[model samples]
Target: MVNEMKVAFATEEKNGLDSIVSTKFGRVAYFVIVELDNDKKIKDNYIIVNPGGEARSGAAIKAVQKLLEEKVAVVVAGAFGPNALVALDEMNIKHIVLSGVKVSEALGQITDKL
Candidate 1:
Protein backbone atom coordinates (compact mmCIF):
# COMPACT_ATOMS: atom_id res chain seq x y z
CA MET A 1 0.00 0.00 0.00
CA VAL A 2 1.09 3.58 -0.54
CA ASN A 3 2.40 5.04 2.70
CA GLU A 4 4.55 8.03 1.86
CA MET A 5 2.91 11.27 0.80
CA LYS A 6 3.76 11.34 -2.85
CA VAL A 7 1.61 13.23 -5.32
CA ALA A 8 1.91 12.91 -9.07
CA PHE A 9 0.99 15.77 -11.34
CA ALA A 10 0.45 15.29 -15.03
CA THR A 11 2.39 17.97 -16.83
CA GLU A 12 3.47 18.82 -20.35
CA GLU A 13 7.04 19.52 -19.30
CA LYS A 14 9.55 17.77 -17.05
CA ASN A 15 9.76 20.70 -14.67
CA GLY A 16 9.04 20.03 -11.01
CA LEU A 17 6.97 22.76 -9.34
CA ASP A 18 7.04 25.12 -12.32
CA SER A 19 5.51 22.65 -14.75
CA ILE A 20 2.18 23.52 -16.28
CA VAL A 21 -0.55 21.04 -15.43
CA SER A 22 -1.68 19.05 -18.44
CA THR A 23 -5.35 18.68 -19.29
CA LYS A 24 -4.82 15.19 -20.63
CA PHE A 25 -3.65 12.74 -17.99
CA GLY A 26 -2.81 9.73 -20.10
CA ARG A 27 -1.20 11.71 -22.90
CA VAL A 28 0.81 14.02 -20.71
CA ALA A 29 4.47 14.03 -21.58
CA TYR A 30 5.63 13.85 -17.98
CA PHE A 31 4.48 13.10 -14.48
CA VAL A 32 5.92 15.40 -11.84
CA ILE A 33 6.26 13.46 -8.60
CA VAL A 34 6.27 15.69 -5.56
CA GLU A 35 6.99 14.46 -2.08
CA LEU A 36 5.09 16.28 0.63
CA ASP A 37 5.84 16.53 4.33
CA ASN A 38 3.41 15.89 7.19
CA ASP A 39 2.51 19.58 7.15
CA LYS A 40 1.58 19.38 3.43
CA LYS A 41 4.55 21.35 2.21
CA ILE A 42 6.74 20.16 -0.61
CA LYS A 43 9.82 18.26 0.55
CA ASP A 44 11.19 17.13 -2.79
CA ASN A 45 10.14 16.68 -6.41
CA TYR A 46 11.16 14.84 -9.55
CA ILE A 47 9.98 14.18 -13.09
CA ILE A 48 9.30 11.00 -15.00
CA VAL A 49 8.70 10.79 -18.73
CA ASN A 50 5.62 8.91 -19.82
CA PRO A 51 6.66 6.07 -22.06
CA GLY A 52 3.17 5.50 -23.51
CA GLY A 53 2.26 9.16 -23.65
CA GLU A 54 1.44 9.11 -27.35
CA ALA A 55 -0.04 5.66 -27.52
CA ARG A 56 -3.36 5.41 -29.35
CA SER A 57 -4.61 2.76 -26.95
CA GLY A 58 -3.89 1.62 -23.38
CA ALA A 59 -2.19 4.86 -22.54
CA ALA A 60 -4.28 5.36 -19.46
CA ILE A 61 -3.53 1.91 -18.13
CA LYS A 62 0.17 2.36 -18.73
CA ALA A 63 0.20 5.76 -17.13
CA VAL A 64 -1.58 4.49 -14.03
CA GLN A 65 0.84 1.61 -13.73
CA LYS A 66 3.78 3.95 -13.98
CA LEU A 67 2.43 6.11 -11.19
CA LEU A 68 1.79 3.06 -9.08
CA GLU A 69 5.33 1.91 -9.58
CA GLU A 70 6.48 5.22 -8.21
CA LYS A 71 4.34 4.62 -5.10
CA VAL A 72 2.21 7.68 -5.69
CA ALA A 73 -0.63 8.04 -3.24
CA VAL A 74 -2.36 10.86 -5.12
CA VAL A 75 -2.54 12.30 -8.60
CA VAL A 76 -3.24 15.86 -9.71
CA ALA A 77 -4.31 16.69 -13.23
CA GLY A 78 -6.75 18.75 -15.22
CA ALA A 79 -8.57 15.61 -16.33
CA PHE A 80 -8.43 11.85 -16.22
CA GLY A 81 -9.45 9.38 -18.88
CA PRO A 82 -12.12 6.78 -18.08
CA ASN A 83 -9.68 3.92 -18.02
CA ALA A 84 -7.29 5.83 -15.83
CA LEU A 85 -10.03 6.66 -13.36
CA VAL A 86 -10.95 2.99 -13.04
CA ALA A 87 -7.35 1.97 -12.62
CA LEU A 88 -6.80 4.58 -9.96
CA ASP A 89 -9.90 3.45 -8.09
CA GLU A 90 -8.75 -0.15 -8.11
CA MET A 91 -5.32 0.92 -6.93
CA ASN A 92 -6.76 3.04 -4.15
CA ILE A 93 -5.01 6.15 -5.35
CA LYS A 94 -6.65 9.50 -4.68
CA HIS A 95 -6.83 12.13 -7.41
CA ILE A 96 -7.55 15.83 -7.78
CA VAL A 97 -8.43 17.70 -10.94
CA LEU A 98 -7.93 21.41 -11.49
CA SER A 99 -8.10 23.14 -14.83
CA GLY A 100 -5.78 25.92 -16.06
CA VAL A 101 -3.58 25.74 -13.02
CA LYS A 102 0.11 25.29 -12.47
CA VAL A 103 1.44 22.20 -10.70
CA SER A 104 2.31 24.23 -7.63
CA GLU A 105 -1.18 25.72 -7.43
CA ALA A 106 -2.86 22.39 -7.81
CA LEU A 107 -0.74 21.00 -5.00
CA GLY A 108 -1.72 23.85 -2.74
CA GLN A 109 -5.41 23.43 -3.48
CA ILE A 110 -5.31 19.71 -2.81
CA THR A 111 -3.42 20.07 0.43
CA ASP A 112 -5.75 22.79 1.63
CA LYS A 113 -8.78 20.64 0.97
CA LEU A 114 -7.24 17.77 2.89
Candidate 2:
Protein backbone atom coordinates (compact mmCIF):
# COMPACT_ATOMS: atom_id res chain seq x y z
CA MET A 1 0.00 0.00 0.00
CA VAL A 2 1.12 3.53 -0.65
CA ASN A 3 1.94 5.74 2.31
CA GLU A 4 0.34 9.08 2.87
CA MET A 5 2.10 12.28 3.78
CA LYS A 6 3.18 12.50 7.41
CA VAL A 7 2.89 15.47 9.73
CA ALA A 8 4.61 16.24 13.01
CA PHE A 9 3.43 18.29 15.91
CA ALA A 10 5.50 19.50 18.81
CA THR A 11 3.56 18.60 21.91
CA GLU A 12 3.85 18.70 25.65
CA GLU A 13 2.66 15.13 26.28
CA LYS A 14 3.02 11.74 24.62
CA ASN A 15 -0.63 10.68 24.45
CA GLY A 16 -2.12 11.04 20.96
CA LEU A 17 -5.32 13.03 21.28
CA ASP A 18 -4.63 14.35 24.75
CA SER A 19 -1.32 15.89 23.86
CA ILE A 20 -1.06 19.64 24.30
CA VAL A 21 0.52 21.89 21.68
CA SER A 22 3.94 22.97 22.86
CA THR A 23 4.91 26.64 22.90
CA LYS A 24 8.51 26.14 21.83
CA PHE A 25 9.30 24.13 18.73
CA GLY A 26 12.94 23.12 19.14
CA ARG A 27 12.76 22.75 22.89
CA VAL A 28 9.58 20.74 22.95
CA ALA A 29 9.76 17.51 24.91
CA TYR A 30 8.00 15.36 22.33
CA PHE A 31 7.18 15.29 18.65
CA VAL A 32 3.95 13.53 17.77
CA ILE A 33 4.04 12.08 14.28
CA VAL A 34 0.68 11.55 12.61
CA GLU A 35 0.09 9.81 9.35
CA LEU A 36 -2.91 10.71 7.23
CA ASP A 37 -4.52 8.85 4.41
CA ASN A 38 -5.21 10.50 1.05
CA ASP A 39 -8.74 11.15 2.20
CA LYS A 40 -7.33 12.96 5.22
CA LYS A 41 -8.23 10.30 7.75
CA ILE A 42 -5.74 9.60 10.47
CA LYS A 43 -3.96 6.33 9.74
CA ASP A 44 -1.32 6.00 12.42
CA ASN A 45 0.54 8.10 14.98
CA TYR A 46 3.57 7.90 17.24
CA ILE A 47 5.86 9.99 19.38
CA ILE A 48 9.58 10.72 19.52
CA VAL A 49 11.65 12.43 22.16
CA ASN A 50 13.32 15.66 21.01
CA PRO A 51 17.02 15.28 21.68
CA GLY A 52 17.67 18.92 20.83
CA GLY A 53 15.92 19.93 24.04
CA GLU A 54 19.10 19.30 25.96
CA ALA A 55 21.36 21.26 23.61
CA ARG A 56 22.73 24.50 25.02
CA SER A 57 22.94 26.05 21.54
CA GLY A 58 21.86 25.16 18.00
CA ALA A 59 18.86 23.35 19.43
CA ALA A 60 16.57 24.72 16.74
CA ILE A 61 18.78 23.50 13.91
CA LYS A 62 19.14 20.12 15.56
CA ALA A 63 15.38 19.82 15.99
CA VAL A 64 14.79 20.66 12.35
CA GLN A 65 17.33 18.06 11.33
CA LYS A 66 15.61 15.45 13.45
CA LEU A 67 12.25 16.20 11.89
CA LEU A 68 13.79 16.11 8.43
CA GLU A 69 15.27 12.70 9.19
CA GLU A 70 11.81 11.51 10.16
CA LYS A 71 10.59 12.39 6.64
CA VAL A 72 7.86 14.64 7.88
CA ALA A 73 6.19 16.75 5.19
CA VAL A 74 4.80 19.27 7.59
CA VAL A 75 5.46 20.52 11.11
CA VAL A 76 3.04 22.07 13.55
CA ALA A 77 4.34 24.08 16.45
CA GLY A 78 3.27 26.98 18.60
CA ALA A 79 6.27 29.02 17.51
CA PHE A 80 9.61 28.57 15.79
CA GLY A 81 12.92 30.26 16.30
CA PRO A 82 14.55 32.19 13.42
CA ASN A 83 17.14 29.53 12.70
CA ALA A 84 14.61 26.76 12.77
CA LEU A 85 12.33 28.68 10.43
CA VAL A 86 15.11 29.25 7.92
CA ALA A 87 16.18 25.62 8.03
CA LEU A 88 12.65 24.36 7.57
CA ASP A 89 12.17 26.66 4.60
CA GLU A 90 15.38 25.50 3.05
CA MET A 91 14.36 21.89 3.52
CA ASN A 92 10.94 22.57 1.97
CA ILE A 93 9.03 21.52 5.06
CA LYS A 94 5.77 23.31 5.64
CA HIS A 95 5.17 24.69 9.12
CA ILE A 96 2.06 25.85 10.93
CA VAL A 97 1.84 27.82 14.15
CA LEU A 98 -0.80 26.69 16.59
CA SER A 99 -0.93 27.50 20.25
CA GLY A 100 -3.36 26.88 23.09
CA VAL A 101 -4.98 23.96 21.33
CA LYS A 102 -5.12 20.21 21.76
CA VAL A 103 -3.59 17.93 19.18
CA SER A 104 -7.00 16.50 18.32
CA GLU A 105 -8.44 19.95 17.76
CA ALA A 106 -5.52 20.95 15.58
CA LEU A 107 -6.04 17.85 13.51
CA GLY A 108 -9.69 18.63 13.15
CA GLN A 109 -8.97 22.12 11.94
CA ILE A 110 -6.30 20.96 9.53
CA THR A 111 -8.44 18.21 8.04
CA ASP A 112 -11.39 20.53 7.75
CA LYS A 113 -9.32 22.85 5.61
CA LEU A 114 -7.89 20.03 3.56
Candidate 3:
Protein backbone atom coordinates (compact mmCIF):
# COMPACT_ATOMS: atom_id res chain seq x y z
CA MET A 1 0.00 0.00 0.00
CA VAL A 2 1.03 3.64 -0.39
CA ASN A 3 2.21 4.91 2.93
CA GLU A 4 -0.60 5.68 5.30
CA MET A 5 1.56 8.35 6.89
CA LYS A 6 1.78 9.94 3.45
CA VAL A 7 1.59 13.73 3.28
CA ALA A 8 -0.22 15.94 0.79
CA PHE A 9 1.11 19.29 -0.40
CA ALA A 10 -1.37 22.09 -0.92
CA THR A 11 -0.85 24.92 -3.39
CA GLU A 12 -2.31 26.99 -6.18
CA GLU A 13 -2.01 24.87 -9.34
CA LYS A 14 -3.31 25.91 -12.71
CA ASN A 15 -3.91 23.14 -15.25
CA GLY A 16 -2.68 24.96 -18.34
CA LEU A 17 0.96 25.19 -19.37
CA ASP A 18 1.63 27.51 -16.46
CA SER A 19 -0.01 28.69 -13.26
CA ILE A 20 -1.55 31.70 -15.00
CA VAL A 21 -3.60 29.85 -17.57
CA SER A 22 -5.80 27.56 -15.49
CA THR A 23 -6.87 29.96 -12.78
CA LYS A 24 -7.22 33.39 -14.32
CA PHE A 25 -10.41 34.32 -12.53
CA GLY A 26 -10.01 32.75 -9.10
CA ARG A 27 -7.47 30.36 -7.64
CA VAL A 28 -8.18 26.85 -6.48
CA ALA A 29 -6.03 24.78 -4.18
CA TYR A 30 -4.21 21.68 -5.48
CA PHE A 31 -3.26 18.66 -3.47
CA VAL A 32 -0.69 15.89 -4.10
CA ILE A 33 0.05 12.92 -1.92
CA VAL A 34 3.60 11.66 -1.36
CA GLU A 35 4.75 8.21 -0.42
CA LEU A 36 7.09 8.53 2.52
CA ASP A 37 9.55 5.68 1.96
CA ASN A 38 9.76 5.61 -1.84
CA ASP A 39 9.17 9.26 -2.61
CA LYS A 40 6.53 8.42 -5.15
CA LYS A 41 3.65 10.79 -5.84
CA ILE A 42 0.03 10.62 -6.93
CA LYS A 43 -1.10 13.77 -8.66
CA ASP A 44 -4.66 14.82 -9.30
CA ASN A 45 -6.31 14.05 -12.62
CA TYR A 46 -8.85 16.87 -12.69
CA ILE A 47 -9.38 19.55 -10.07
CA ILE A 48 -11.61 18.45 -7.23
CA VAL A 49 -13.58 21.67 -7.21
CA ASN A 50 -16.95 23.28 -6.80
CA PRO A 51 -18.25 26.14 -8.94
CA GLY A 52 -14.90 27.91 -8.72
CA GLY A 53 -16.40 31.13 -7.38
CA GLU A 54 -15.81 33.57 -4.58
CA ALA A 55 -17.57 32.74 -1.26
CA ARG A 56 -18.18 29.26 -2.60
CA SER A 57 -15.69 27.84 -0.19
CA GLY A 58 -18.19 25.17 0.70
CA ALA A 59 -17.85 23.71 -2.75
CA ALA A 60 -14.12 23.51 -2.39
CA ILE A 61 -14.41 21.72 0.92
CA LYS A 62 -17.01 19.34 -0.32
CA ALA A 63 -14.89 18.57 -3.32
CA VAL A 64 -12.08 17.72 -0.99
CA GLN A 65 -14.29 15.57 1.16
CA LYS A 66 -15.34 13.58 -1.85
CA LEU A 67 -11.69 13.02 -2.57
CA LEU A 68 -11.14 11.80 0.95
CA GLU A 69 -13.52 8.94 0.22
CA GLU A 70 -10.99 7.73 -2.33
CA LYS A 71 -8.53 7.19 0.50
CA VAL A 72 -6.47 10.36 0.14
CA ALA A 73 -4.28 10.69 3.16
CA VAL A 74 -3.26 14.33 3.11
CA VAL A 75 -4.06 17.69 1.54
CA VAL A 76 -1.57 20.49 0.88
CA ALA A 77 -2.95 23.84 -0.07
CA GLY A 78 -2.58 27.60 0.22
CA ALA A 79 -5.94 27.87 1.89
CA PHE A 80 -9.03 25.81 2.56
CA GLY A 81 -12.81 25.81 2.74
CA PRO A 82 -14.66 25.06 5.99
CA ASN A 83 -16.50 22.08 4.58
CA ALA A 84 -13.24 20.63 3.38
CA LEU A 85 -11.64 21.22 6.76
CA VAL A 86 -14.45 19.56 8.64
CA ALA A 87 -14.49 16.68 6.22
CA LEU A 88 -10.76 16.28 6.43
CA ASP A 89 -11.05 16.25 10.17
CA GLU A 90 -13.69 13.56 10.00
CA MET A 91 -11.73 11.53 7.49
CA ASN A 92 -8.43 12.19 9.22
CA ILE A 93 -6.71 13.47 6.13
CA LYS A 94 -3.54 15.42 6.90
CA HIS A 95 -3.43 18.95 5.50
CA ILE A 96 -0.71 21.45 4.62
CA VAL A 97 -1.21 25.00 3.43
CA LEU A 98 1.26 26.82 1.18
CA SER A 99 0.78 30.43 0.16
CA GLY A 100 1.81 31.86 -3.26
CA VAL A 101 3.90 28.88 -4.22
CA LYS A 102 3.68 27.00 -7.47
CA VAL A 103 2.43 23.41 -7.29
CA SER A 104 5.73 21.78 -8.22
CA GLU A 105 7.66 24.05 -5.89
CA ALA A 106 5.21 23.34 -3.09
CA LEU A 107 5.69 19.64 -3.66
CA GLY A 108 9.43 20.06 -3.31
CA GLN A 109 8.96 21.98 -0.10
CA ILE A 110 6.76 19.25 1.29
CA THR A 111 9.33 16.64 0.36
CA ASP A 112 12.06 18.51 2.16
CA LYS A 113 9.96 19.08 5.23
CA LEU A 114 9.40 15.37 5.48
Q: In terms of TM-score, which candidate is strongest? A: 2
What C-alpha lDDT do the candidate models reach, one value each? 0.85, 0.86, 0.49
1-114: candidate 3 lDDT, tens digit per residue: 654345544434545212321222223544334444554453333343323333454555545555565566656655666656676777777666665555556556666544
Please provide TM-scores, in order, for all candidate models, with all chains considered together: 0.90, 0.92, 0.55
**Greater-lDDT candidate between 2 and 3:** 2
C-alpha RMSD by candidate, in order: 2.2, 1.8, 5.2
As a TM-score, model 3 comes out at 0.55
In terms of lDDT, the poorest run of 10 residues in model 3 is: 16-25
For model 1, the stretches where C-alpha displacement exceeds 4 angstroms are 1-3
Which segments of candidate 3 are over 4 A away from where they belong? 1-13, 16-37, 41-57, 112-114
Which digits, one per residue and each the tens of the lDDT, describe model 1 over residues 1-114?
A: 433488988888866788888888888899999998777778899999886597888998999999999999988888888888999999999888875677888877778655
Model 1 worst lDDT window (10 residues): 1-10
After TM-score superposition, what is the CA distance of residue 99 in candidate 1 from its true location, in Å? 2.7
Error of 2 at 35 (Å): 0.5
Root-mean-square deviation of candidate 1: 2.2
